[model samples]
Every structure is written in C-alpha cells, then in structure tokens.
Target chain A: MSENRVPEEIQENAAHEAAKLGIGTDEWVAQHEERTARKKGLKGVPQFIDESIPAWARWVVLLAAAFAFGAFVDNQYLLRIGVNLGLFVMLSYGLNIVMGYAGLLDLGYVAFYGIGAYGYALMSSEQLGHHWSTWLSVLIIIIGTALLGYIVSLPARRLFGDYLAIVTLFFGQVFVQLVLASDNITFPWADDYVDITAGANGIPGIDPFSFFGHKFLNIRDYYWLLLVLVALLTITISRINRTRIGRAWRTIREDALAAESMGVMVNRLKTMAFVTGAAIAGLAGAIFAAMQSAVFVSGFDMPLMTMIYAAVILGGSGSLAGAVMGAIVMSVLPEVLRVTNYSEILFLAVLVLTLAAVGKSVKRFTINIVSIALIGFAVKILLGFASIKITPTEEWVVGPVSRALSHWMYVPLDRVLWGNCAFVILIVLIAYFTTTTPRIKTILLPIIGYLGIFLWEVRLVTDVNTTRQLLIGAMLVVLMITRPQGFLGKPRVEVL
Target chain B: MSEKKPLLEISNIDTYYGVIHILQQVNLRVDEGELVCLLGGNACGKSTTLKTILGMVKPKVGKIMFAGEDVTHQNTPARVKLGMAVVPENRRLFGPMTVLENLKIGAYVRGEAAQEDLERVYDLFPKLKERSSQLAGTLSGGEQQMVAVGRALMSHPRLILMDEPSMGLAPKLVEQSFEMIANLHSQGVSMLIVEQNANMALSVADRGYVLQTGRIVLEGEAKELAGHEELRRAYLGR
Candidate 1:
C-alpha cells in the first residue's frame, strides 16, 4: 500500500516524462497493474503477502522471534534442536521449488546435502583427512553441493510426476548405502586408522565454523548462523518465485502442454528447479556437519525422509512456513520422544489420533484421519517387534518389494495379530460412524484415540521390524482412498 | 490498391505435428498495409499457418521473408522483436492478470519504451482502461478478446496476426470485433486474420486465401473470393 505514495520529486520527474509521452497519470497506473497481473497470476498469494512486509522490518521480527524462542525454551539442548530445525527449513525451502513449484518430486535431495557436509568435513577434519581452514572448507562445500545438484539435474530435468521422484529417491538411497557399505572410503576423516565416517562411531573434533579467525562453537552462535542461512534461503527463493523464471515454473506446473505452446522452454525451468533445490539441501547439510562437528551415514536415514516430508506436508507444500513447521516437528519430535516414557512412535500415534478424533465431523477431515492413521500404524508396527531377531540379511541393496515385505513380516506373525485387530476395529469404527450421528457417537474420540496411542507407545517398542512397514503400506493405501493429497497438501486438480 | 511491393513472402511451407501434417506448401504474400485473410472451416490449418508465420512451429521446408530477411529459423521472441505480433487462438490472455497486464505481456517482447505502446493500445481500446484492474479471466468472452487484441497492439507491430477471434462469441460481439479489425486496418497496421467465418473475414480483407486440408486452394481479391461459387458453396453456407 505504501507503494502508492509518490514523493514530490518523483511526481515532478514523472510529469516531465508524461508531457513528452503525452500520456496521463491514470493511464500509467492502469497499464502498470495490467502488466503486473499478467506477470503475477491471480492465485499468487505469496507475492501479495510478501509485498506487505518490508525487508528491513522483517529481519527485526526474525531476529526477535529467534531470540525469544531460544530464551523461552531455556534448554540449551532444545535450542540446539531448534538450530537443526532451522537448517532443515533451509533444506525444505529448496526442495519446495523442485517438488512444489516445478512439480518435480526429488527424493535424492539429501545426496546434495551430503556432498556439502562431506565437502566441509573432509577439508576441516584433522583425523584421517587433510586439514584446511573452515572458511575455505565452507566455500568448497557450497561449490561441491551446487555441482552435485547440477549433475543430478541433467538427468532429473527430463523426468516428471512420479518417475522423477523414484529416480531421486534411488539416487539418495544409493549414496547412503555406498557410504555405509564402503568402510574404506568413510574412514578417511575418522580418528582410527581404519575408519571412514568412523564406521558408524562417527568422526569427532572437526573444527567449528571459523570465519576470519572467529570460531562459532556455542549453540547461541549456531542459532545466529542458522538464522542467517534461513533468511538468505527464504529471500532467494521468494525472489526467484516472483521472477520470470518462477512464472515459467508455475506455467509448467499448471499445464506443461499449454506452457510449451506459449513458447516457454519447459526443460530449462525443470532443470532450474532441480538444481536449485539440490543446492539448498546441500547448503543445509554443510551447516549441519559444521554444527555436529562430523558427518555420519546413519544421519541420512529413511525415517528422516518421512519426518521431512511430514513437515513439508503439515506446513503446506510450496509454502516456506509449512517447510519451517515441518522441519521443527521433525527435528524435535525424536528428542521429545526420548524424554517421555512414551516412545516417538507413541507420540506420533497420539498426535495423529487426537487430530483424527477432533477432525471426524469436519468435511475433508477423513483425509487427515487416514494419513494420520497410516503414520500411527507405521510407528506402532515398527516399534512393536524390535526384540525379534533377524537372520541372514544382505548388506547391499535388495529388490524393493522383497525388501519391503521382508521388513514388515520379520517378527512372529502371531505377535502382530493384536495390532491387526486394533487396526481393523479403528477402520470399522471410522466407517460405521460416518453413516449416522458419528459426530455425537465419537464425541470422546480424541481422548479414546490418544489413549490407544499412549497405551501402545508407553511399552517402549525400540527395534524396528516388519510391523512398521505394513502400517506404512496401509497408510499409503488409505491416503489414495481418502485424501489423495495427504493431510495439509493441496489436492491436485486435473483440468483438461 | 497501390500495387506496392510485398514486404512479407512465404513459400512452400510444410508444417507437421507428429504424423498429422497441418500445413502443406502454403504459399502467401502480403504487401505493406494490406489486410489478408486465410479463410477456412474449423481445423482447416488457418491457425497453423498463422502460428508458422509467428515462428511458434518450424516448417518442414519453407522460406519466410520479412523485409527481405529469412526468419523461418527464428524463435517466437525473435520473430516478435522483428515487429511481429499474434492474437493467439482462444485469446490466451494471462487469466489472473488485469486487462492491463494482459496487454503488457503482449508487449513483453518490446524493450523499455513499452509504455508508449501501452498508451497507444489503451487509446485504441477504451473499454480496457475502464476495466484495467479487473482480472482478465473474469471478463466476458468479448471483453477478453478485446484485451487480447489490445495486447498485440501494445507491441507496435508492423503486422498483426489473429486466429479465431470470433470463436464462441455472441453475434453482436462478433460484429463489433470485425468492425474493430476494420478500424485497425484504417490505422495502417497490416494484418493476416484467420477466421472460420469466411463472410466476416472477406468483408474486411483486401484479399483472401481459401485453404483446405493444409494447402491454399483459392487465392484472389476479397470481392472475387466472396463471389466464387465453389468457396461460397463450401465455406460461406450459400
């Protein structure tokens, strides 16, 4: 709105130009809005909101919010967790471009993150690797991540919808598996002579980020570091989203055929999204490695994928706030799970059940319920059979279906009979309640759901088994049936 | 007609989409300030020829000469910058944008002094100024078409190409749209209009070409084309 204000100097200058052009003030304004609307579409909610918040003013709010969150949480450990969450916010924002704006799902986002992490780790660590200054390492990490992103994008740009996703996921999984399987390569930065990535023990005493000879070793310093990165990431993404390139991405997402018909180069836009998202993930990885003082293969777990996606979905796909919220829940949930007698599985179960019970009467609530139930079921089944021993599991990659079925069916089939009954009962209850005054019947649903989740979680299920994977498979089916968009993600509309 | 030399010459243009060859050896020419109409029924390659001229698609083999320069290999933006403008089929106005934004993007290929063209376009279509802030998509079909035309005009193009501007229009709007085209002609802008309504197109056209399948089967002065027995029987529903 303040853009309405024209200083006298500008008005005078404008008047002189107008006299030469022989055009009136009203005409100029009308044409400006017309041009802007064409450049920015009607569904452009982000830019509309962004224009209202001035840059300098926003920074002050960001700093205040960060410090307040740090001070109020009071625990240095939690604050450290918060810093990690911020790092993920940077990562998710990057991922949002490829997966959100460009409609390209990239599962190998973390591989770029690893590149940056290892770029810094190998250069900065003094154990089995050569030592370099933190500043130089930081530069190397950024360049390395960008290069990795570009390399991956060459193939990724050609893919779209689900194929791109599967390939990227495969790419990321292969990288992690290689690191885990190859002990020779990982130990270069290890303290021991035979350790690369310290063989799961992980390298330690990698120097904290030292720029211009000033080291940032404390949580407070790390918090500032994260804030700076998050802000830069947000600004860069926001600007890119508003520019001509961003318009091309949206056009492609909306209708690729129509976009190409309009002479927009579709391949170029897709490549930009893939590369940019990878770069962001890489940046986050570098910062994370610096904070943790080491890189570990175990850090890039499959469960971390679920958590990051959950955050992205919960916050709102393509929305920065959604990414931030998603990262926060993911980074902190495990820690919170550790503190309570209720395991992380139970925490998620309870959270989901409560949401579903409360959401039952709401139209479109069933979608949320289904996804939550799936997540809960996943956690429940995975946690229940940690004690069951497995024999003769291969070290390298297994075929997907076999691997999936093996993971879910590992424990004694009878042990999960109770879980099957409970899951069936929940489904029956959901189905039965939908027909009549289900709202009134399930008035106490939230309490009942959380109690069910709590009862299962309090038993401290630890070792992951086949039960979790089955739950996840069930969850995917439920998602396709109920809320194809998943909870909090915008349902995709197909307009021919 | 002054018998001025043709500024744009098209020869033996063959355009294909996969197995469907849309334009076959389509030869056409336009002298300076002449309004030409490529008239046909729906799906008769009138639109495809316009697109080929705009460089939206490459011809299998043809020479497109603009001011004696070969531009068949040029891209859309390059062609546009060379004083070419198109009111695309279906009037693909940027929907969520204001009427003004629709016009602005039309002149997007134009450099910094685009405001001059913007004013010229608005003066040409006063209705656009009235609903300047209104989202182009929400506008009535007729109004949207006006925005599309105004947008093309914003580029200050020497030659304007339009495709099916009369599609899905009420009779009155269609009449007004043709009148506007005639008015544009009076302003010295050369035009190549592709229209399914042969009657309306020939009314404003200095000359007309009748296309069937992908090739031009008849070419003559507008009056002669209008009076032709075969064309009238085939297209004008005589």
Candidate 2:
C-alpha cells in the first residue's frame, strides 16, 4: 500500500469476479497474469515505436519495405499477388470507414466499387468509343460513386442495424441483377434494342491509366500505384479520425442514442460516413478497373465483399494498421495455399501456435506435443493389424517438408473416403472433447491431432483453393471465438 | 437568473414505450443550484422520466421547460446544447475509448472550450486524471461511475441528469458517489438524480419525488420524504 502498486487489490477482486463468471481460481490467475504481462509488453513496444521513430520515419520505413518487396519479387504471378494485396489494403480501408468507425455494416459496399469500375469502364473503354484521359475518368468515377453512396444512404441510414444490412445486401443483389440483365434492353417506347452494359461477358477493352503519357502496363506498375494510393488513403482517413467528425462517428458507433444526447447529428453523420467510405471504395474500383483493363461484375460479388469484410474485421475494425495487416494476410493466404510447401508449413505453424496457446503450462504443452508423436506410432502399429496399405514416401511426396512428413504420416493411394471421414470425425471429436472432462480431452487430443493431419494430407492437400477457403473460414471462426477485436485491435468491452 | 426559475421543469409528462405507458403524468422539477432525487423501484419509470427530460424518450403528453423554453419536441443533442447532460444507466462509458477520450466526448458539443471543462472534471475526480489513459470499460465500478459523472460535467450543463449512479457499486463507494453528488450541488450545479436506493437518494437530495407504477405517489422536501412511512417499508427497509 505504501509503494502504491495498485495491482494487489485488483488481483484480489478479480478472483471474486472470476468466481462469479464460473472460472476456476487457477485458470483465472493464469489468465490475469498473461493479461498483465501482455499489457506490460505492449506498453514498452508502443512507447519505443512512438518515441524513437517519428511518424514520417515510420512511413518511410513502410514505403521502403513495400518497394523492396516489389523490386525483389520478379515473378509476374508474385507481382500479381502484390497488386491484389494492395487492392485488398485499399478495400479494407474503405470498409473500415463504415464498419469500423461508423459501426454500420454496409453489405452492399461492393456495389460502390462496381459503380466505380463501370463508371470508369464506360468513359474509357473501346466499347463506348470514348477514350477519356485517366484523371477525368477517375474523378468522374469517384464523384459518381460518392453521389450513389449518398443516395443509397438516404434510405439505408435511417434503417437501424439488421434492417440496414438487409437493404444494402438487396442493393448489392440489384446491382448484380441490373448489370446481368442489361445486355440488351428493349425500351417501352422504342422498337430497337440497345446493347448498354454488354451483359454477362462484361464490358472489355478498358484503357489503363496513362498519366502524362506514361502508361501503367505491367502488373508491377499497378502494384506500385495501389500501394501509393493505400498510403494516401491511410493518411487521409487517420486525419479525418482526428477531427471532431471522427469523434462524432465513434460516439455514434458506441451508442447511437447516447451520441444523440451528446449533441451529435446521428443520421446525417452516418450518411456522411457512408459517402466517405463509398468514395474510397470507388477509387479502389477505378484502380482495379485500370489495372485489369476490363470490368466484370464477377469481381464485385459477395465473395469479394466477404474477403474485404474479413480483412477489415480480422485487422481490428477501427485500426488502420490492423486493416493493413489483415488485408495482407487475406490477400497472400490464397497465394501461399496455392503452393503445397507454403500451405503445409503454415498449417503446422498454426497447429503449434494453437497448442502453445491452449496448453496452459509448459509441462502440459510438452505432454501434448509428445502425445502427438506417440499417436503416430500407435496408429501405425494398429494399422498393421488392419492390413491397410501405407504407400511409400516416394509416391506422394512433392516437397522437402512433405518428404519429412512422409515418415510419420499415413499416406495411401486410395484414401480419399477415409480422409474425408477422418476430417468429419476430427471435427466431432474436438467438439466432443471440449464438452468432456479434462482427462478425456487430454486422452482424445492426440487422436484428434492425427485425424486433422490425416485430413490435411489426404483431402486438403490435393485441393489448393478449397484449402485456402477452409483456412480463411476457420480463421474467421477462430477470430470470432478467440478475439473478435482482431490483430492490433483493442479488446472491446461491450456494455449492455 | 430571471427570478430563480426552475432549471428543469418536467410538467405532468406521460411517457410511453409503444402504448405501455411507462410514465403517466409524471411531474418533476429541479430549481437552480438544487439537487432533486426521483426515487422508485424497478420499472417505476424513474429512468423514463429522466430520459423524457433528456429528449431520448418523448412524452406522449406534457411540457418540458428548460430555461423557460418549451423543449418537448426538441432533439436530444439540441437539448444537450441547451445545457442538458446525462450520466446514463449502467455508466455507459465508451468501453473501448480511454477515460480522457470519454471525457472529451462529454464536452463534445462544447467544442474548443472542452479543455477547461476537462480540467474542471479532473479537479473534482483526481483518480480520473491519474487513469486518464486507461480505457473506460476497464475501470472498476466506482471508477466507471466517476467517469460517467465526470463526462456529464464536461458538458458544463446548467442541469445534469443522473440515472442509477450507485446501482453496481459497493456500499462504501455508493456513499462516496453520493458525497460527490452532494459536493457538486454545493458548487451550484443543479441535478436530477434517479435512483432505486431511496435512502441514499433522500440523504443527498434537497427535494425528493416518490414514484410507483408510472405515477408520482408523493413529493416533498427531503426530510419529509425520508420520514414518509410508506417509503420506509417499500425502499428504506425500515
């Protein structure tokens, strides 16, 4: 008490609070220690970063790193990934404005992006026979998108939460439907049909941005362009957040009714947030259009929107830095998954991470890891009695990592049925284990790990896209379960 | 000011939650530089009456006069600008934001002058100043209550509305909170505090209103209300 170290009282009270929450004394203590240590660790690093490195220096470091990556990665496929990642960064920033700052879930945000794409495509495409300059086209697209956003927000902003979500989702569907149906339209008054939207095949031959007679032809150019734009948007958005408007938006998100009482014009500000997010999305769409030199409705569908949402949510909605990290993860995950070696390493790393996080103590963690090793031997011995054919490592091994895995893994030529069954069983076992006693969980974990590996080798390994999708879906689920605030996001305390 | 008119005058207001008629003909008032407590049990529309004054819950029938202006139809922020501030039920501080940020938002409608108000709040609650950087949600119950009250004060309102300031606090902390409320009243800040703890409310209040089942059953000076036999059985547990 004399030293004024306040944790003594708080720690005592935390025990009582934990008991009320139904957590055991030991578990609560451990969690508290971890939380306190994490806070201490975070405090030091952020202080060091802020004090030692100026904001400009940090940006310089980031830009330098981005450029170095661009210069080093020579493969066109890798460059394409860079561009995609940059685009994802932009999209996440756009979505962050509405979802993070305003706390409005605009499911039809993709439509704004689509509007930007089509707006640019129409003015600068061969189909339209009007090749506008890059500056004019982008300006028109942004303004048009902002206008569309303002219009959409007129009705949607008044709708609260779920209702707003539904309206925006319907708007997305409408955009898709209108574009899909607009191939050949018969006017009510006129006889002849007009080819307006170019329909399902999409409007092609869109001109790339030629800035001052300097054309952006290569994937690297688009990648650089997007990176620069992302940097610019990040600065702009952060500045906006520092203003009274930003504080007002956050207040609205915290409690709309409370914010109103605090003298904030809730509805109008929400509308403004929508328009702002829309403008950014539109800019990203314009760049996307120019990069691809084509406009397809397929690129602006639900999955793309989901990917963007996942990035924003994963990074921590209100944090720009979190958004960037999340965007890069969401973008590069599929590309990494495309390669067997990268995906295998990632899966094993993640599994190890999960084990370390959940294991509680070092002794327990060691036991869990050891149990996994023992499970492999036990399964192998059991398989011998069953007379199942275990293929030689030579046949299935693709990379050095898999070659090493071959010694332990149960690889078989005709194992798809068993593999799929193992995957389902693994899920069930994990679920069941959670509900069971600790002893049961400890005993079943090894089997669960083996089953997971079996599923990975047999089913997930053979398919890249599906594996990527599974990993992302799992990532989202894990995020929701473990930490909804996402990486770099502050843990939110939801007040009732 | 202007012959000592009531700072907040809620005249026979009937507030409803979609025909539920949560508050019926509920009349309450707080004169300048006075502390008034509205005491009631659960769902007795004490909070509804406060919300009605704050413009969160519109009255189906009545007049709410603030500084002699009819503010029944005015919006929440407009009322706030006209010097109305609330420490909401459950101390609804912006959970993710720092205590400083929350306090800043309390003076949000005040704009540039908020810094001075913030200093004033800090002066009242030194603990808030010490833990200014800590998130509002992470604070202990007493600390959160302090932040909530401090936030309301940041608006530098002519009249402050408090909703259940002592609900989750320990007995000692509740006493401390009431003392702070009393301290504020002494400093010429008019307040309308709604609470279920009739005993605590009465101890600090200059005037008190007793509400039950959406109606004001009694109203008098604090000393009279404290001695009311019915209030003793129902609330003070005499």
Number of the top candidate by TM-score?
A: 2
Flag regions of model 1 displaced more than 4 Å. Answer: A1-63, A71-74, A126-128, A155-174, A177-205, A255-270, A301-314, A325-416, A428-496, B3-7, B93-140, B150-158, B168-180, B183-185
CAPRI accuracy category, model 1? incorrect
Question: How would you encode candidate 1's per-residue C-alpha lDDT over B169-199 as one tens digit per residue?
Answer: 6555788899999999998889998898889
Give interface RMSD (Å), model 1. Answer: 10.9
What is residue A11's positional error in candidate 1, in angstroms?
51
Residues B18-54 of candidate 2 have per-residue lDDT tens digits of 8698988878888988899999888888888888898
Candidate 2 residue spans exceeding 4 A from truth: A1-34, A39-60, A71-74, A155-158, A352-395, A479-482, A494-496, B227-235
Deviation of model 1 at A157, angstroms = 5.6
Local accuracy by lDDT, each model: 0.68, 0.83
Q: Please report, as a residue range, the 10-residue window in candidate 1 chain A with the lowest summed lDDT.
A: A454-463
Strongest candidate by DockQ: 2
